[model samples]
Target: METQNLGSSPDVRSKNESVKSVDRRNFLRSAGMTTVAGAVFLAGCDKDDDMTPTPTSVDLGSGDVGILNYAYALEQLEAAFYTQVVATPFSGITDAERSMLTDIRDHEIIHRDFLKAALGNNAIAGLEVNFSSIDFTSRASVLGAAKLFEDTGVQAYNGAGNLIKDANYLLIAGKIVSVEARHAAAIRDLLMPNSTSFAGDDIIDAKGLDKAVKPADILAAVKPYVKTTITASNLPTS
Candidate 1:
């Protein structure tokens, strides 16, 4: 897939550099989620029936490779969703809405490609998505799906951050999640004016920390569109 480089927003770029400067060892230690060895470790566990649907499998390799594939799977889903929205715009979709979604589609495509490149032969095959249930003709339906996707993407990154042993991989995820958060906020405002879309209990906790949804929760939310089951058993576990 061809991708256009969307130059980083100033604020995001600065934050990315700051995150890169942090000592990986110290960061992981402070988070209390780090394991002793740098080696990738996987715990053998049965696939959760609720998370894995009866869909075709996308082979994202073992260890960090698997994590990259996991992300690629999500990007494939998002890219397909936004492509559909652009191809057949929903009724009453504003010109601004169309433009913003197009930009998001471009960004996702770029992210997907970057991950694929990083993974090389380890990258998983592109997964097929079935968006037939979405009503492309209705503005409410389109925006609703976008909201769900963006929110899910952000939460997925947050939940998975601690599990990543490679500092570079974690940095990339941090960059991507910031963009996802921006997308979520923008979609929220479009849906409801002057109201914070990510300010609710769904994305934030009572302690003011951002909410992180587990992989099982994310897969369950995405189950409808994915035709094949995704196994995260190969992923690294702390």
Candidate 2:
């Protein structure tokens, strides 16, 4: 359950200490979603926006912090969506379904908190999730959305892996990426019982590696769940 070691240097050890005891539930509830990359957030709510938030773009800052913010934002989205799914279980959800979904929700919260802790003050404000597009009462709808998020998360981490310069950060990313992959597999299985569903052709390449997704593509993919227009103008592309 612990994140991969960043390094043996004293400073790295010090920061890693914080990652150990983080309370993800409290962290998610307390943190505010911050907008970086010169992006704007929709602060003003109006009559036409009955829970339909129209927040402006989130500009994740440049460098490692930017990458951290990017991961933080996605984790926020996943956590929020899973929270809603568990909160309002579909009418016919089995006990096993509820338990597994809850586990996924917890894992997402952990990842979100870990990124927040690792980024420290550099971390962005907590994201406000917009789940209106989802019908929480329906099993198929919930499973579909989970599949999208879990798979996308795996791809996001894989794509961003090489851009990280710090060895510890890279290690940490690898640890989290594997977990995300597992979540994707579980979600895929839930959608379809068996027969190579977990490793769908869409996510895998001929080289047998999971797909890597650019930051922009991920932002656009999860745009519906978030109220803000996220811009990764400053995120490291290469």
Candidate 3:
């Protein structure tokens, strides 16, 4: 597959100098952490439609590769969304909101780039995204979408934890998920200031745990945003 460079906003381009100055080994050591093209799914294809041509299927290989690609896919979507958010700056966006969203955008870009580098040739092709449902000019629309993506990401990492077989991969995943959880909380607070919505009953369970959605469900929910048809048939089930 051809390696596709996910385009960046001007801000991301400007920061490239500082980002490149960091020693790669040191960055990977401290971050252990953390693509675009269409949105991606772990292993399932969207429902077939007689009226539409079948979309090309990109397989996420099994084991650690599948998991990493799964994450790469989400990061790609997030980076794309936030890049647009920062570039356009929704109507009535406050300075605080702009700064916060810009930070999130940079983080997502880092995550996406890290995963791509880690996967190297194993990574799937860049995906095509569809953001038609989102009204970027509207604050409520953008923030609402941000909240959904962040929350869903937290759940995805939580649920996929058990599926990861490599100890090192699991450790890196843990680190990444913590950051994602923080993003979710921050977005929530922005949407509902001074309220219990940050850890509200909607996402928090009676056991004081966040929801851990299965791969199939997560893919289904995010399918609309992605224009590519991804196949996760090889993902670990047990």
lDDT of each: 0.66, 0.70, 0.72
lDDT of 1 by residue, 1-238 (tens): 1112212223432444334323322332333222211111221121223343434775555666777777778888998898888889877555555666776776666666667666765766667687877788877677778888888888888888887778989887887777777677666655654345446566777998777876667877898898867777666665
lDDT of 3 by residue, 105-204 (tens): 8678767776776777798877678899988988778888888888888888888899999897787677777777777877766665546887977788
Q: Ranking by lDDT, best first? A: 3, 2, 1
- Candidates 1 and 2 compared by TM-score, better number: 2
Score candidate 3 by lDDT: 0.72
Clashing pairs in 1: 55-227, 55-228, 55-229, 56-228
Per-residue lDDT for 158 in model 2? 88
- What is the TM-score (0 to 1) of candidate 2? 0.76
TM-score of each: 0.74, 0.76, 0.77
* Candidate 3 colliding pairs: 36-127, 37-126, 37-127, 37-128, 38-127, 38-128, 42-232, 43-231, 43-232
Candidate 1, 86: how far from true, in Å?
Answer: 0.9
Q: What CA RMSD would you report for each candidate? A: 13.0, 13.8, 11.5
C-alpha positional error of residue 9 in candidate 1 after TM-score superposition, expressed in Å: 32
Model 3 Cα RMSD, 1 decimal: 11.5
Runs of candidate 2 with Cα error greater than 4 angstroms are 1-57
